[model samples]
Target: MKFSLYVVAVPLALLGTVVPASASFAAGPAGADGGAGGTAPPVLRLTDGPADKAAVAVTRPSPDGSVATVPVGDARLTARGPSGGLVLAPARSPAGNGPGDLAQVHAGDVVAGPTTQDTPHGVLVKVAAVHANGDGSIAVDTVPATLADALGDAEVDATVPLTPGDLKAKPLTSGGKVTAGAGPQGRGVRLNVDVPVPDGVEPTEGHASALSASLDLSPEFLFSYERAHWYGVQPSRARIGMAADYQYGVKVHAKSSASYATGHKPLRIPAAEVNVDKTVWLGPVPIVLSLKVDYFYDVSADGTIAVDAEEHTDGRLEIGARYDAGEGWSALSGPEPVSTATPALITGSATAKGGVGSHAQVGLYGSVGVAADAEPYLKATATAQNTPQGASASWGLYAGLKVNGSFFARLDIFGTRVLDKDWELPPLRYEHKLAGSDV
Candidate 1:
């Protein structure tokens, strides 16, 4: 079944309140007017502590008449902008995550704090601040939740604000919910599991199924004729192969397409590898378990780690499982020391990548391996006109990018690398061939 694997972005609004200066303090009756039997008013006194801060200008007089005049002091204060006259106040100091570091905490709409609040849907995270001590140690503190929810989950994780090398954090929650169990080493289960389904189908309590299939064709036309030696040695040969495979399964299946080269020229044809898996439900509702297994030709020690996105009929997204084994690493190509006892390397990926509205696909299937200390070869002759008789073994990876239905192209870069010994092959030992279009 297809599923969404990308992060969803949403819009946010700003909300805040400010108090006006006139409402800050109210002065008592200027005359202290006691209605009946008025006594003498208490003498008013003024005290000046320091200069008024340079930035703080008294825009309006205090109603309580208790304003103390002070010279400009350096104390910071919040002020509203001139246009709208919005009031600003001193914001509370943010708490620290650990020693000398700031902590991230929030104080609103919390779902999984003091109570196991069941939220409609949201992301949750664990946070801590760690300070690295000089003695190769660290100090950690839990992140405060005072920060806005949006900032907390996305930016900061469950990490402490300790020294750079002093802190470690474990994932605590995601999707607006606290993760089950404890730290990273703790064993816990996902709150929900994904089940595969076909396009345009919504998942229900019962079992869901999905299927995918593709057709491929490759043709190699070659013409060759050899000279007849008068010494009674006439060499002529030709060969061609084309095969196709098909499969259907719950999660994945296996299928392939292959073609051989005509004559002695090596046939660089395509191959097939398919897989499907599904989740089986006991009753009509809620899936209990899921099983997924794929088929692909592994030609190298490092498996395929390639990823590409595709949209399924059911409005879900799928990604191709391809691998990039760093430099000097090739997928669908086995290791250099190819031998019977040596390990077998395999690489392949499956996904209808790129393009839109289906019909377009980018799949992977091929073999890449190594034979140590051995020059593996098969000999043959060429017949007819223009055919060449030569033995060739290609070792490299192929990447295909297709668009629409009929417009497709792929580039295969093949070369041999000796893994067992570097200087084994002489400079002239290597061979190069460009077989496809524009080559």
Candidate 2:
């Protein structure tokens, strides 16, 4: 007698909305100068040199809107026309000191002492008033002191309001050094400073922290086996039989968003897919099978202290068998159970002071010639500790899969078993991790 079987299994369709990538916010621009005369207003420069070399000389703005002071030690102040330049010399006497102090100038101001060539015609330094705007912008009223006749005949006084569109920012260096400089442009001044937020994050008055997170789908796991069995010791009575295969893995569609001092936005990840298919011949019976798994996940971080995650899974399997001859083939089994909904195997959250994780396992069994098991897991953790004199915060997320299974077949003649065997496949595993830190 000759027989054949064919099977086809379809898994459930994946679900859930994917969050869009974060939007990038440009740094505010330097405010326009409100002075007349078409003369380019004098700008402040870190006479010390490039930001990397003069980092220590430049101070950063605080959350309280305090001024970031920059020393004017021998810094040169060049204006547009001839005799429109002056050197920022230190005050020689207490009476010669500007409103603020000696050599030191606030973030948005330019200060200088009496000129070396002419004490009476030396430049006077006027401090600037810095304000933090509600819409993530900084405004500065750069009151350039009345220029001495030796430098310029005009009084360069103006209230320049710098907006987020007015300032330009550069990437932070390894040492957290920010580039700082200011220059005059068409009766206006341009100020460049370092604000340590990621490209996509916007920093408002109260919020100024950076955050990033992600989720990924790993490769699938599959196993297959084949063996032959003989019927009788006769030449024409000889027969070959027994072949099997097994496979299982999930495709993950996930989205993540974060809320911190900086800001919040949704980030999306492409879906990952894992599919398995195999064919086996049991004597004159031929069997074909396939399986698929799909799932969705969402992760969010609230402030700098806590994180949460949630997930759902829709799994499916299909098996079909048929008999094939030289002329045609006959169907032995049709696709019935189209899909299966599997509960989330693992879920959990973590905090800045500790870490948490979860794990879950599932099994699949079939009579034709296939059986297997799968384990999926997720873990989240955050660490905060003192390092000698400083403290640091670190967070991470980990996920992966592990699978193992077997394939077998048996035959009997006249109530006597003639052939029986099984093949065991080794376990397979895959894992991924994402991490970030702040000090």
- lDDT of each candidate versus the true structure: 0.17, 0.24
Residue lDDT tens for model 2, 1-439: 0000111121211121211111110111135332342222122111112212111111222232222334322232323124333223232332311222223334534333322223322233344554443532233344333211011111111111222222223333231221212211121111111223323233222323222211111211121111111111111111111111111212222212333222221111111111222222111111122233222222233323333332221211111111122211111111211111123221122321111111111111111233333333343456666898797655654543334444333311101112337444344444455333321
- What is the clash count of model 2? 28
Could you report the Cα RMSD, in angstroms, for every candidate shown? 31.0, 36.7
Per-model TM against the reference: 0.16, 0.22
Which 10 successive residues of model 2 have the least lDDT summed?
A: 1-10
Q: Give candidate 2 regions above 4 Å deviation.
A: 1-305, 308-368, 375-377, 406-424
What value does the lDDT take at residue 371 in candidate 2?
A: 36
Q: Write candidate 1's Cα lDDT for 321-395 as tens digits.
A: 111213332211111211111111111322111110111122111111111110111111111223366543222
